[model samples]
Target chain A: MKAEKILEALGEIDEKFIEEAMNYNMKKKFNWKPIIAVAACAAFALAAIPVANHFANNDMVDGGTTAGTVAPVPGDEVDDDVDYVAYEYSVNKGEIIGNHVVELKVSKSRGRYVIKDKLDTQKTVYLNGMEWTAKYENSWSETDYKVIVDRYTGVCNGRNMSFGVNSITGKCEFFMFKTTGDIDKTVKLTRDELYEIAYDNFLSGGYTEDPENYQLSDECSNGSAGYWFKFTRFVDGIETSEHVRIGLRNNGDLYWFVGNRIGEMKDVDVSGFDMDKIYDAIEIKVKKIYGDAYVDFEREGAVLRKRTDGSYVFDYSGHIDVKNSYGKVVQERCFLIVIMD
Target chain B: MTDETILEMLFARSEESISAIDEKYGHKCRKMALGILGNEQDAEECVNDAYLGLWNAIPPERPSSLAAFLYGVLRKLSLKKYRANTAGKRCSYYSDALDEIESTFASAETVESALEGKYLVEAMREFILTLNEENRAVFLRRYWFMESCREIAAALGTSEKNVTVRLTRTREKLRKFLEERGVEI
Candidate 1:
């Protein structure tokens, strides 16, 4: 077996990151963000929320081993969970580019996940005072679960009612006591009762939901578990991309409140988007990226994507359904197109 | 030459594409390799091998940055060459650099599963974003750009010891940071 190359691994942490760092070195433009920041000050110019929040000396202990001199001890075993003691710190403000400083905030339950499997689940819950039935697409993976546990803090309110979101990976889930902690029986509750518990217990943990624009979408369950009720939010009068859901156990305790789905970003007027020209460019660009000229794709309406520097640019996203000559759909993949000015 | 022009030549399979790359990125790639392998001959071999790899990869991969793509290939080739050259006694500038960081994670009881490729990259990305300009540049030059502490110190008009001391402190802090974030040391 080949030895793990630490140097190579560190060098490639961000192929893009290294490029940006190189550019910074070449340009000699000094960044002042780290003076007020904590550790992780040895990176590229892009300022991200610190994964570890608190301020500490971070100096190595005098004992143990020194760098590069200590050899791996054979027959030694260690547990990852026990050793992981990271307290992630999030930064809202970013670099000041031009006159605008953009602070990018996102949902906690957002991270890259290898889709293990999507579990179809459904249930009903009262929104404000009205009962709504909703469906859910839930997935469970050990790696994904570890990722969430490692990053977010959650509260276990008896009978599987808990609220948590690991911001880095963007995993947000909140469980409520839907039915008196029992799956066999349904306990009835009034509007006032549901509203009090939902707002006070679960909603305080960084979840912003609009009671007026709450819309019920679908409901289903894994049969063995309580049903999940999904709801979409429309903040103010404008519709956003965030999704909020509440799950119910058969014995009538609103056992779950999950707010997820990609957030609807900066409201920009993309009405000037030239449908014909953009699609033509996408057709060519997708071919170049994927190496398949016959990729049949569609472009959703364009929106402004916010960069770290608080600047917004026109961007569009769509997916391509690559079908064989037989017209049978063989594969599906999503792609993003950024329209740079 | 601009990356777009070089890319177009490569896409056209023009023989001049290789020369363009040579003219544009050859010295940069060679210096990068020299940092890792610590020898001119091996660094040159790594550079040539990297060019060949780029010739084969660019047709299907339209990288956002051609220099990054080429550097990625060259760095990998250099690491391979360094490994082959250091069988009896593992010694090189690259090894020295790795040794500096190994104090953070190289342990008999280290959890290998906790240190995954994707996670490290993302962690490093987040970590880098937290740095200020001067410290960040010194740290990146030594680690990412594969420059020596002396070189970085010279470039920044500081003592070699200062660069090494700053990096050591910063890395130790990173150790604490990752550990606090549940990264297995």
Candidate 2:
């Protein structure tokens, strides 16, 4: 029909349908957690630098330890006029280079000297601790430093590293951890698990390697935050590999982003099942456990749905399964209800 | 107006509610129903049915826009009635019009495809918001209220052919708008 006619028909519609639809909307209230999480993330960024300093002061360094200094060079000192080159870290490994300062956080506890960056801030690095100071040079590439340990004591690992941030390569490097064992073992997390890990990392401090490069705000106290996670997995016994990246913005909202493709869960409800085993988990439960109602399961995209008597159903979209409590798939059919409503 | 006010008046079976709706939108609703059904009796019946539906629905339902809510209900009822009455008829005007527009999507094998649930409604809302006030009113009058080209022209003080052209252009715009938002047609 003509658009105008269709609009007219829509305009002339009876009031009952509108009421019913509105009632449905009221019944299914929109989740506000994601919005609150985003707001909290913004607040955290504003107050992050000061809080880091506050914690650093309480956990202060001993006297005689070398403190690195960084300052912007005078414009008249150099004949060449270059806009301030914000230092950043490379995209490789677990480091994130940014325009201001490089930041990285390691999950596991490694040796002492191995944790410190090449900058001569301090020899000892503490967990959840940040050290910020000024550098002498105008450019990062021009400076050089070595990773040193007290030779007489011989208490820490001896791993020397140095780099410079110049106009040609204006990048600041932040190293998190060094893996000595199998890298495969370190990366074997399901998409949901990886998202949770990443989200936690972002919440604690921040990740340097994030493409979004979200930083903590100065005004943020402590609330919920969001982040993304990417992990590499070996699928087949043969030579085949795949990268699984999941976008996790809210505490419970998990979005699938495979390769270059990104979309919300189609028909799945990610509320049920363990978030850790979300990769290949199937949950089956009776919708009306003691009743005569039969449950049916349907798959849409990577999600599963459970319905009872073709009316009420539960969605298990982006969740991972750890236990198959519903019995074997080859035997009798099983159904799981993720959400009660 | 607040839904509480509407509901309070509706549940009380207040003549004021009916009078208020009639005084404000009765002619407009009648014109739209007549445009779609092409019969005065059916159009009047649709409007009365709309009132009764509104009376019954207000207690549990709170609508953001009373006019839009009423229009939506009336349209559904009108369409259902039209379908039932013309079940075995040979190409009724209302059926023909719907079929002509619906055929394009049917041929593309997307006529049966649901509009991704709420996305379709959202898209339609967005599309309506983009039109100019006059055009938006005209569009709503014709499609939502089911007013004829002649009736719309009379209401807007324009020619019937101009109304037709404007409607055609609007349809094309809507089609493109829906397609951009990933709707099949």
Query: Best candidate, DockQ-wise?
Result: 1
Per-residue lDDT tens digits for candidate 1, residues A214-330, read 555533322212344455676675666566545543224454433332243345555665656756776776565434424566666545554333444445444465533223453
Off by over 4 Å in 2: A1-341, B1-8, B15-27, B62-65, B88-108, B114-116, B183-185
lDDT of all predictions = 0.48, 0.39
Error of 2 at A88 (Å): 82
CAPRI-style grade of the A/B interface in model 2: incorrect
Q: Residues A99-202, candidate 2: write the lDDT tens digits.
A: 11222222222101122222232333221222112221111111111111111011112221122222122223221111122111112233345445555654
TM-score of each: 0.39, 0.32
Q: Which DockQ values do the candidates obtain, in the order shown?
A: 0.11, 0.05
Provide chain B's TM-score, model 1: 0.86
Residue A16 displacement (Å), model 1: 3.6
Candidate 2 steric clashes? 66
